[model samples]
Target: MNWQDQYQRWKNDQDLEPQLKEALHNMNENEIEAAFSGTLEFGTGGMRGVLGPGTNRMNVYTVRKAAKGLALYLEEQGMADRGVAVAYDSRYQSREFAVETAKVLGVHGIKTYVFTGVRPTPTLSFAVRHLEAGAGVMITASHNPPEYNGYKVYNEQGAQLPPAQADQMIEQVNTVADELAIAVKDQSEIEAEGLINWIDEAVDEAYLRELKSITYRDDVKRDLSIVFTSLHGTAHNLATRSLAQAGFDHVFAVSEQVEEDPEFSTVKSPNPEEHQAFEYAIAKGQDVDADVLVATDPDADRLGVAAKKADGEYHVLTGNQLGALMLDYKLANMDDVPRNSVMINTIVTSQLGKAVADHYNVTTEHTLTGFKFIAEKIEEYNQSGAHEFVFGYEESYGYLVEDFARDKDAIQSTLLACEMAAYYREQGMTLFDALEQFFERHGYYFEDLHSLKLEGTDGPEQINAIMEDFRFNPVEGAIAVEDYLTGKRTYLESGESVDLNLPASNVVKFWLDDDTWCCLRPSGTEPKMKFYFAVKGETREAADERLKQLKDRVLERL
Candidate 1:
């Protein structure tokens, strides 16, 4: 249906959710247009959007629609009886949305194990595999703003739904004619009937147990001071417990941001990748003269770190730098890594860590964009028995040290980063210092990201136009270009087109001369366009200048 018909369909529903109706009543013309112009789509990961009352918004109606689609998909696969594991974070309405999801599945006679309280997305991934469930659902927007929420689907293997599975689920979700009128079984009734059950401690215990495998240097002094903040999301208790279990007991929690504050009042945005998210943690670190400050996003699946330099001011490490530090630390320390091990990162992520992996004789692989592609590769490797997964990371503050949970896990990264800090601090150094040394050892590899937000009706069109112009129109000095959207790579010198051999996406990349590269793509989660720049140089200053030159060259044309 068109916007008018979609809006009218919600208005005419007798059992409309009151919150949704009120949101619609208060919306202005532009808000209405944005809300009804199109439905929030579920991609390889899942659907995410602002909370409101429309086809384009996230609400109970949309959550139920997604759950029904997932139920249908499971039934078609003959796996509905194996049930689904449901978990949520501390976002607004996240728990409620999770309860709604469970109810929808319950009404369809599909069993569910719902978390009584909010948990991290990684825990949910572990729960799915621990319970041997058919699937999993996590109600979170993963570092999105306070107004936003999301629905993520996971396979039984405890990874995000692969592209093929997500495609099938999307087709089923869009089949719904009217979501506002959809009804679900009562939560109390479902629990009494045993269709919905709360997940037990066994799953959490199992996940925490697996975390120990990532902890390498427990023999190091646990007295090193570290400040960890959850940014008012779901990482407080989990991080504390994991750190304590990993033998780092000197952690200081940022008191203000440790609680479940749905508004995320302390920071402008809860995203760990942003520097402002560490405001409270930095203050706390300063108070205690801590060695390192760590943070996790709302869902606790992405981690960020800031360490004190010689001047005593904290320097936040970019994802690339930290990934390199962790990669080198991991390879240099692990005594019994599997032979023929592999490491994976996305196409847009920096290659500094790749150099570290290469030094250790581990093969490096690149995925399209999301961690699901990496997870899919892990599954293939495990099945074929040709390679063992070592580590996977992305420039967007996502990392996976172990394949136990198949998704980017902040818990594991947090543990290892803390241990890394302690390991260096014992030698009178810090993580920032370790990062500089890493660059010295592995050559200076720098990566930067610039994002442009395009919201409302014209935003998507503008983004599409940008990609199209860049794809067809040639850049002046690019030696080669890879358009993942078309799944083709154009070798300019040879004028030969080769298949990209990766999943198709709305992304274009240009390979310049001398290890310099840039990638343009629309963000899968938000209404923004991201430009990723990667370059290598003899010095940090040279890399920054080269990056700026390339950035100015491309952005001026845009």
Candidate 2:
């Protein structure tokens, strides 16, 4: 049916919820068209969209459809009896949506273990394995704005559904012809039948015990003053407790952002990557004379840090810088470095990480831009025994310290970061000073990310046009091009082509003669095209200049 007809059908449905009916009545023609244009996409990352009433938004109907699809897929595999785990963050309707998912799965005779309250995304990943469930579902949008929400699925290994399994899940999700027609049992009925189990502190204690196991240095000077903020999402309580349990006594919590507020009213955006998100935390840091400050996003999977410099001003560290610092600290302090240890990062990540790994005699591996790919390698190494998984990180503020959680764990990273800062403090230096020393030892490495947001109906077409333009056209000063969509790397100088040996994705990377590189890829979870640039030089000024020039040249073509 056309969008207009679909809009009318939704408007005319008597059983629609009051909130959706009110939203439908208030929407204009353009809003109606956008809402009914098509179903929200369920990709490898699962589905994410604005919160509202429509096929294209994140509502109860769409969530139910997704749950039903997962149920059918599990039943088909004869794994429904193994049960599924469900968790959500502090977003609006997150708990409601999670309960609705449980209801749908319950009606299909599938068991579910649902969290009693909000939990971090990484905890949900751990729950899947700890519970020995067949699958897992987390209701979150990570660091997206307050108006957005999402649903992510995980395999039995506690990792995000990989491409092959995701494709099959997408096929199952598409089989449900009508989103509004999926039936769900009442919550009470499901509870009475033992189909739904509520999980709380038992799992929390187990996860925390595992997190404490990752800490290596308990003898470091614990006198460091730290400021922490959850940005009004989950992780405030757990984060504070984790630090205290690890023997850090001077931790200060950002009072304004510590509570679980769905609106995230304290900051303009809940994302910790942006410097503006640290306004309250920085203020708290200044008030307490904190040696370092940390902020986690809504789901608490990604961490951001700002450390005090000699000038008494705080400098925010990029994801790449923090990853290198963490890796260096971990390897430097290890009593004995494992011979077969390996570190994993994405293709777009800075080369500095690989440099650090090489210094420690640890191997490095590269994957696509998702943590799941990194987790996939960890699982592979677990079975093959070729390499021990040491660390994993991506440029977009995600890091994984251990394989206990298949996704990024900001809690784990936060604890270790505090210890690293304290250990450096004993040397009478700050993290900023350590970072400069790191740059002096290694080449001055710099990186930046630029995103172009394109929303509405024509957004996808415009993005596709840009991708096609770069694919067929020759870029200036380019030596070779790696097109992940075609799974080939072609040398422009000679017409030689070779396989990338990675799964196909819509990413294109350029290798330049000057040793600087850039990559262009559409975000798998958002409606934006991201440009990643990295460069290294003998001096900081030279690296900064080269990075700017590379960004200018690449963006001018778009």
Off by over 4 Å in 2: none
User: Model 2, range 57-118, lDDT digits (tens) per residue?
Assistant: 99999999999999998988788999999999999999999999999999889999999999
In lDDT terms, which candidate is top? Answer: 2
| Candidate 2 structure lDDT | 0.92
468 Cα displacement, candidate 2 (Å): 1.3
Error of 1 at 189 (Å): 1.4
TM-score of 2: 0.98
Worst 10 residues of 2 by lDDT: 511-520
